[model samples]
Target chain A: MHRRLALATAATLCGALALTACGSSGSGSDAAGPAAGPVKLTFWSWTPNMDKVAAIWNAAHPDIQVSVQKQASGDDLVTKTITAAKAGNAPDLLQAEYQALPTLVSNDVLADIAKQTAGTKDRFAAGVWQQVTLGSDAVYAVPEDTAPLALYYRQDLFQQYGLKVPTTWAEFADAARQLKQKDPAKALTTFSANDSGLFAGLAQQAGAKWWTSSGETWKVGIDDAAGKKVADFWGGLVKEGAIDNQPMYTPAWSKALNDGSQIAWVSAVWAPGVFTSSAPDTKGKWAIAPLPQWNAGESVTGSWGGSTTGVTTGAAKAGHADAAAQFATWLNTDPEAVAALVKEAGIYPAATAAQSGGALAAAPEFFANQPDFYTQAAAIAKNTAPAAWGPNVNVAYSTFKDAFGKAAQEKGDFSAALTAMQQATVADLKKNGFKTEG
Target chain B: MSTTLTDRRRTAPAPGTTPGDAVAPPRRTAWIPTLVLLLGAVYCLIPILWVVMASTKSSGELFTTFTFAPGSGLLDNLAELSHYRDGVYWQWMANSALYAGAGALLSAALSGVTGYALAKYRFRGRTAIFNILLAGVLMPPITLAVPQYLLMAQAGLADSYWSVLLPSIVSPYGIYLARIYAAAAIPDEVVEAARVDGAKEFRLFRSVALPMMVPGLVTVFLFQFVAIWNNFLLPYIMLGDDHKFPVTVGLYSLLQQGANAPALYTLVITGALLSVIPLILLFVGLQRFWRIDLLSGAVKS
Candidate 1:
C-alpha cells in the first residue's frame, strides 16, 4: 500500500510539472498563428448591451468577425488595457474613457486613427471629437458617447417652495438659499465630497485647461485662476449651507434622492437614468433644464463621464488597422450602431445624427414630459471648450478629490487647495519624466 | 469518551471565552453557554439571510423597501441570471468547483505525505524545512500574487487555469495543520510494530498512519477548499478570460458593471446569494470530521 502510494504521489508531481511546462510553451504559439482563420478580432468594452452593436456589425461584415468582451469600468479598464497591451495580448479594438486618452497616448499604446482610417472626423459632436485628438491633427479614438452637463430638478419641490428654475449662478444661489430656508432639512442637492471629476468639469466650463501643450512641452495649471474662480463659486455656496455635503453613490445619497430630502442634482446626460432607476416612484415629479450659467446670460456647459473606441498599437501589429478602425468608427457613429447604444445600452450617443432624431428626443416620462431636453443636451455638446486631461490625470484626479473637499470646507478659500494640487501635479509629472511648465 | 466531551461542550469554553473570563463549572447553567453559541451562529447567519431576502428585490425596490422584506422578483432575478452572458454564472460556478475540488484534494494528499514525514522522521534540515514552509504564511497574498503574475506571464501561463491551480496547491497553513494532526493522531508504537512486521516505510504510513489521520486531514482539506473557493485577487490579477474566472472574480466584474448601470445590481445581488449556497453546503457537509475529532482524542501518537 505504501509503495503504491509513493508511486502515485511521484506520478502526480511529474504530471503537474509536465503540465506547467506545456502551459508555458503553449502561450507563445497562439500569437504567432496565421491571420487567415476567419479574421477573428477581439474587442474589449465596458459599455453594457454591446452584444447588439456586435450583432449589427457582424451581419454586414462577414469577412471580419468581432467579439466584444465587457470589462470592469473606469480606471480598472485602463489598467487592464495597458497591461494587456504591454503583454502583447490586448484586444484589437478597445473602449477607453475620454479622460484616459491622454494616458493612453503617452503610453504609446494607441494607433493614430486619422492616419489609419478614412474620413470620419465629421461623425461626432464637436466637443466630443476634440477629446480624442492629440495636439491638433492626430486623432487617437472615435468618440462613442458624450455627457453634456444639465440640471435635473424636482418639480414638486420647486413648486412646494414657490421657486423658479434658476438660470444663472447668482439666481441659483438665491433660489438655493430660499429653498434651504423653507426647509432646514432640505438643500438644493448634495455636493459630492469625493468627486474631483465634477470640479474638473466645472473648471472646464469656466475655461480652465488642466493640461495643454505648447510646441512639445506640456503645460499644467491644476490650480490656475480659472480653477480657483470656479472653485470659489461652489465653495461659497457650500459654506453658506445652500447645498448638503454627501458622498455620491452611497445608500444615504440614494435615500436622500428617493425620499425627496434633496431637491436637485446637477448631472450629466447619463445621470437621469440612475435617478429614474433608483427612484422610480419619482417618475413625472422631476424635470430637466440647461445648467445654471456661470454668467447671467452666458451658455457655457461642462461634461462629466464619456467613452471612446480606440484601435490599439497591438492591433497594428496584427496588420488589420484599416478593418479595425472602420469597425471602431462604425461602432460609435453609425446610425444603427448608435441607436443600439442608446436604446439597448442606455448610453448617450456622441453622434450628432443619432442625437438629432431619436426616441430620446421625445418627452421623457421621468422628467414630466419635457420636450427638447435632449435637444438642449445636443446643443451643449457643440462648440463647448474641451479640457486637456494630462497623462497623469488619473492620479491627479484622485489627489484633487481630497484637496477639493478641504477647499470646500475652507469657506471660499479655494486658492490654497488649487495651489496645493498644482504643485503636487507638477511634482508627479516631473517624477514621471515629463518636462512641465507652470 | 466522545459522548462525555460533547456533553461537556457547554463548559468547553466558547471561542472568545478567555482564561480570565472563565466561570466555575458549577456556577453557570447550561443555558448560558447554549445562548452564547446561538448568538455567535446568528451573528454569522444574518448577512446570509439579508442576501437571500435582498436578491428577491427589484432594482428600485431595493432602496425603497425594508431590507428583510422578501420581494416578488425572485423568479425574475433567476431568469435574468440564467440568460446573462448565456448563463456564464454557471461557468464560473463550474470553474470554482474545478479549482477548489481539484486543488484541495491534491493539497490534502501532499500535506498528508510531507506532514507525516515531518512528524515521524528526524531527517537533516527537517526543522529548517518545516520552519521555512511555515514562514510562507506570513507573506501577504498580494505580494505573492503580483510576483506570481509576472513569473506566470514570463512562463506564458499568465491566463491559464494552471496559473491559478498550480499556486493554490501549496497551502502552508494546511500543511501546518496536517503536521500537528499527524503528530497527535498516529502512535509511534504502531509504526514500530508495522516495521517489525516487515512493512515498508511507505506501506506503514499508508496502512497505519493515513487512516488514523483521515478526520484531521479532512479539516486540512476543508480549509484549503474554502481558501481556494473564495480566492479573488490571484485570479483577478491573472485571468483575462471570464470563462476561466472563479465566481468571486466573476461577481466582482459584475459588481464593477453595476457601478455605472445600477440596474445590474439585482443580478449582482442574485449572483452573490447563489455563490454562497455552495460554500454553505460545503461547510455543513464537511463539519462532521471536526465534530468527531473535537469530541474525542480520536487517535494518539
Candidate 2:
C-alpha cells in the first residue's frame, strides 16, 4: 500500500509538470518563416459552396493550389480576417459579406477587384455591383450572391384560416391579428432576436440607408424618418398580438414552427427551401409571396446578407491572386459551375446570366412545386435599390437590434428607442473615426 | 464485486440522514437525494434530447418547426452530411479521435513519470518546483494559446496536426492530479523493498508501483482524453486548414455559413449531435474508473 501511494503521488506530480511545460511550449514560437513553395493561396470563406469550389479548383489547377478554410459565422469571419491581417499573414482571397465590404474597403484590406476585372460593373447584376461600390472610383469586392427578402408562409395554415395572401402591410397585420385572435398560441410573424441582420434588411425595404457618404462626410440615417417608420411598424406588430415574443436564437421559435404555432416568417431568397427542408413534413404545404410593403411603389425587396470575394493585400503569394479572381468569376458566372454551386450550397448566383437562365426557372420542386419562385426572386432583385451600408454598419445594426427588441418585446417607448439607437450610432461612427454629420 | 459495492454504496443513507449519521439535516423528506438526482438528470438530458431530435430534422424543418419536435430527416441528414465534401465530417471525426486518443495517451504517460518523480524524490527546490507546476493551473488557456500559436508559426508548424497535438500532450492539470494520486497511492517502503531486491529505480516503478497506480492512471487518461476532445478555442486559433480541423471547428464553420444560407443550421445541429456520440459512449463505458476524490485523498494521506 505504501509503494502504491508513492507511485501514484509521483505520477500526479509528473502530469502537473508536463502540463505546465506544454502550456509554455505553445507560447514560445513567434518568428515568421521565410516564404516559399507553390503560389500558396489561403482563401477564407463562410460559404458551403467554397468547399466544392476548392475541390473543383484543386482538381483543375494543381499548380495553383487553393486551400479553402471555413469560418465560424459572419462576425467570426470578420474578426478572424482582421486578426489574420494584424498578424501579417492573411489569406490570399477572402469572401466577406457585402455589408462588411465598406469596412474592409476603408481599411485597405481588400485589393481593387475593379482594377483586375475590367467592365466588372457591366458583367454582374447592376444592383449587386452598385452595392459593393463605395463612391464613383473605389470598388472593394465583387458580389457573388444576392439575398432578396420575401414572405414565407404555411399555405395550409392560410387556407385553414380562410385568409387571402396579404399584399399590403396593413392587410398582413390584420391577417396576423386574426390568426392570433383565432389561436392565441400562434403568432402571425416572428423575427429572431439573435440576428441583427434582419434589421438591416428591414431598414433597406423602408428606403433608409444606414450611411450615405457625401464625399468625405458620413450622413448617419439609422434614426431617419424612414428607419423610425420601419421600427414603429415592427414594434407595433410585437405590441399587438401579431408577432411572437420569442427571438430567433431561442428554441421556442423552432418549437413554434414544428408545433404549428408560428404561421409565417419574413425570409430571404434562401429561406424557403431552408425552412421546409429543415421540416420536410411541411413540404407541399409551404408557399412564397412578395413581402408586404408599407406602401405601393415602396419596394418590399431588401438584401439580408450575401458574400463578396476580395483579394487580400497582405497575401504571402500574389502568384495565385489572378487565378483566384478567375476562379471566383467562374464560380459566380460560368453556367455549369454556377448551377453546380446552386445545387450544392443553395446560394443564388449574383450574375444576371445565372439568374436569368433555366436553372432558376426550373423552380425547386421543394416549395410545393412553386413554378414562379425565380420570377418572384427576380422581381425582388429588380425592385431593390442601390442601398448603402456604412463602414460602421455592424456596430449600428447590433445597437439597433437591441433597441428594437426592447421596443418590440419589452413594450418600451418607440421614440425613446429611436433616440437611443441614434445616440449609439453617432457614438460608434465617431469612435471608428468617421466624420458624422450633426 | 466492485460493481455491487458501488450499487450498495449508492443506496446507502446520506451522510446526514440517519439518526446515527455524523451530520444532521433539515429532515423535511427522504425524497431530496432522488429529487436532486432527477433534476441533474433533467439538466443533462435536455440538451442531449434536443440533439436527438435535431439530428432527425432536415435543413428546412430545423428552423420552421419547433426545436424539440422530431422530424423524418435523420437518415437524410446523415446521408447528406456523409456526402458533404466526400464525407469530410468523418475525416474530422477521425482527426479528432487521433488527436484526442494519441494526445491523451502521451499526456498520461508523461504525467505518470513526471508526477511520480515530483512526489517521491527528495530533490533541490522541491517545494518551488511543485509550486511552479501548480502555478500553471492558474494561467488562463488563452495566454498560453496565443503565444503557442505564434511559436508554431515561427516553427512553420501552425495549421498542422502537430501544432495542435504536441502542445496538448503536456497537461499541467494532468500532472497535478497524477502527483497527488501518486503520493497517496504509492508507498515509499515498496521502493526500498524493490531496491533491497536488487531492482533499478525505473524497474521498481515499472513493475511494483505502476500495477498499484493503474486505477489512478486510468482516471488521468480519461480526464486528459475528455479535455482534449472538448477543446475548441485551442484548435480554432491554431488550425487554418479545414482538412486538419476537428469536429468543433467544422461545425462552427457550418453554423456561420448558415447565417446567410440558413440551410446549414441543420447540418450544424446534426454535426454537433454526431460529435457528442463518441465522448458520451466513452464516458458511459469508463465511468467506473473515475476517481474524483483523488485531490482530497492526497490531503487525507
Candidate 3:
C-alpha cells in the first residue's frame, strides 16, 4: 500500500512539473506602463515581525506599497518560490538565503537589478556583496544579513574546569580531551551531524571551494583537502569519545546546554537568540569568541546562515522591478530601515555600515554580560572566507546530512561519508543536465 | 441479511451451556491478546500523552525535567499563544473550521448525488465513468496538489479560499463509498414502485433513497471533515497570505521562523492541544449517526 501511494505521488508530481513548464511559457509578455494607483508589491519573507518593518517602509513610500507575506523558511521555501515563479504567480520580492541565489538564478526566478542597486554595493562587505552578484556584473539580490561563525562558551564552567580559551584547532581538540578526562559525565561540545551548513562553514573557513564554475561547466569539490581535514578532525574526536556525537536542535541537546553538560558551542552570531530560549538558565554565563583558527594566527572565519532580498522575474514582467529593487536596496542599506530590521526582525545586518553602531551598539538582553558583543561579531564578520554555491546546493546538503548522520552514529569514517556526498552531488548535477567537470 | 442472521445464530451459545456460562465465573482471560492490545493502546497514546505533558512546561523546564512530568507553564503558554500577532492562531483555527466544515458538507452532498445516480441509473458510459472514479480513488490526493495548484493559477484563483475548498470538494473515495452504500441499502423494487405511482424521479430519490443513504453519507462527511482538517500540503501551497492559512501551516511557520530565532515550541504545543478539542467534540457529537444500520428494514430478504 505504501509503495503504491509513493508511485502515484511521483507520477502526479511529474505531471505537475510538465504542466508548470507549459504554463510558464505562455505568460512572459511584459505588461507596459505605470499603474493608475500605487504600485503594490508583495514580499515573501520568513523573518519574524517583518510586517512591522514593511509597515515602516509603507508609511513613508505611499507610491510603492509593499506587503510582507510571512513564509516558512529554509530549502522548502526555495522550492516553493521556484514553483510559484513557474506558475507566474510568484511574489514581487523574496527573502532567499545566500546559497539559494544560484538555484533561483538558474531557474530564472530572480531578476537582475544591478542597474537600480549599483550605488548600494559600497554599503555592504565585498564578500557579502559578491554572494548576490555571483561573481558577475548582474546583481540578483541585496545582502540582508550575515551569520559569521563564532565560539560561545560557558564562562564560569571554563573557570571551574581550569581551561583556557582555545585559539587554534589543536588547542581546541586538546581542551576537549582534557575536559573528558576531568569529567566523563560532560563534554566540551558536540559534533552535530544533522546540520550540514555548520560543516560547510567549517570547510569554508579552511579555504575549501565546494562549488566553482568556469563558463558553462561546473566543478564540485565536496571532498577536497580542506573538507577532508575538517571532517577527519571531528571524526577523530567522536571516535575517541572526547565530544558528544549526538545531533543538535533536539530536546536532549537543549538539556545539555541548559545544565552545562556541554560547556561550549561552535556556532554563529545568532547563538544568543537560540540560547535565550533553549538554555534560558545559562544566559549570563556565556561569552563569545572568534572561531578557533585552522592555523594558529589566522583571523579568517566563515558564515553559516544569511539571507538576501531579491526582486523576482514576475515583478519585472509586471513592470514593478524598479520599485521592487528600490525597496530591496533601502531595506538592506538605508540606515533607518536597516535599524528597524535589526530591532524588529533580530537579524544581523549584512550592510557593513549597520554592523557596529546605532541598533547594534548595545548587546542583546540575553547576552548582557558581553557588553561589546556586536563589536566582537563585527570583527569576525570582516574576514568571512568567500563561499561558492551551486544550483544544486539542496541536494548536496541533504546528502551530507544522511551520510554524515550514519557515520557519526557508528563513529565510522567521515572521509567515506564525504566521498558519498561528493558522488551524490555530482550525480544529481549531471542528471539535471548541467555540464560538469572533475 | 438472512445469511448474517444465520451466522449470528450459529455463533450463539448452545442451549445446554448457556445456564452454566451465565452462572459460572468468567472463562480464563486471554492474557496474551489483552497484553498485545494494551501495548498497542500505549503505543498509540504515548505521543499524545507526551504532547499533553510537554505543552505544560516552560521552555527552561521543557527538556530538563522528566519526560512525563507536568510543569506549571500551561497558562503562560496559552496567553503567549493568544497574544501572538494579536491572536493569529485563532484566525488559523477559524480558517480551518471554515474549510473543513464547508468543504465536507459540499463534498458529502456532491458524493450523495453522484453515487445515487451511478448506482440507480443504467445510462450509457456509466460503467466507464465509475471506473474512472475508481482509478481516481487509487490516486493519492497528495500527488495531485501541484497539478491542481497550476490549474487554479490558470483560473486566477490561486491564493484564495476557493483554491483550497474546490479541490477538497471532489473526493473520489467519498463518492466510491457512497456508491457502494447506496447499492447495498436502497432496494430497486421500492424505486420502481415509487416510479409506478407517477412520482418524479427527483422526488422519489429525495423522499425515499436519500433518507436511507443518510447513514452512509454521514460517514463520508466525517471522513472528509477530518481529512480536510489535517491537510497540510494543499493549504500550504495554495495560500500565500498568512491570514488565510489553516492551523497546520500557521504552526509550521511558527516553528520555522529562520535560523536566528528559536522555534516557539511552547506556543505551538499549546495551540496543537487546543486545536484537537474541536475534533474530539465533533467526533463525540456525530458518532450517534454512525450507529444507524444501512439496510435496516429497507428490503424484505
Best by lDDT: 3
DockQ, computed on Cα atoms, for candidate 3: 0.38
Per-residue lDDT tens digits for candidate 1, residues A1-438, read 455445544433433343344336544513554356656777877777786689899999998888877666768668766766676667788888888998988887788878764577777656777789856788899988877777889988899899999988788889889988889898888777587777778788888989987766789977778888877777778888888766677767787889898878888777767877678777777777778887787888888877888998877777778878989878886777888887778787777788766756675556646677677777766745686787888878777777767666555466677787888888888898888776
DockQ of each: 0.33, 0.35, 0.38
Off by over 4 Å in 3: A1-34, B1-28, B291-301
True interface contacts reproduced, per candidate: 0.30, 0.43, 0.51
lDDT string, candidate 3, A1-438, tens digits: 355334333323322233343223333322324659899999999999999989989999999999999899989899888888888889999999999999999999999999999788888888889889988899999999999999999999999999999999899999999999999999999999889999999999999999998989999999999999999999999999999999999999999999999999999899888998899999799999999998888999999989999999999988899999999998998999999999988999999989999999999998899999999999999999998999999999999899999999999999999999999999999999999999
TM-score of each: 0.89, 0.83, 0.92
Q: What is the Å distance of residue B192 in model 2 from its true position?
A: 4.5
Estimate every model's Cα lDDT from 0 to 1. 0.77, 0.73, 0.88
Q: Stretches of candidate 1 above 4 Å error?
A: A1-23, A26-32, A359-365, A405-415, B1-26, B29-46, B121-125, B200-202, B258-260, B291-301
lDDT of model 1 at position B246: 92
**Candidate 3 chain A, run of 10 with poorest lDDT:** A22-31
**Candidate 1 backbone collisions, by pair:** A2-B202, A2-B203, B186-B301
TM-score of chain A of 1: 0.92
Task: Rank the models by lDDT, top first.
Answer: 3, 1, 2
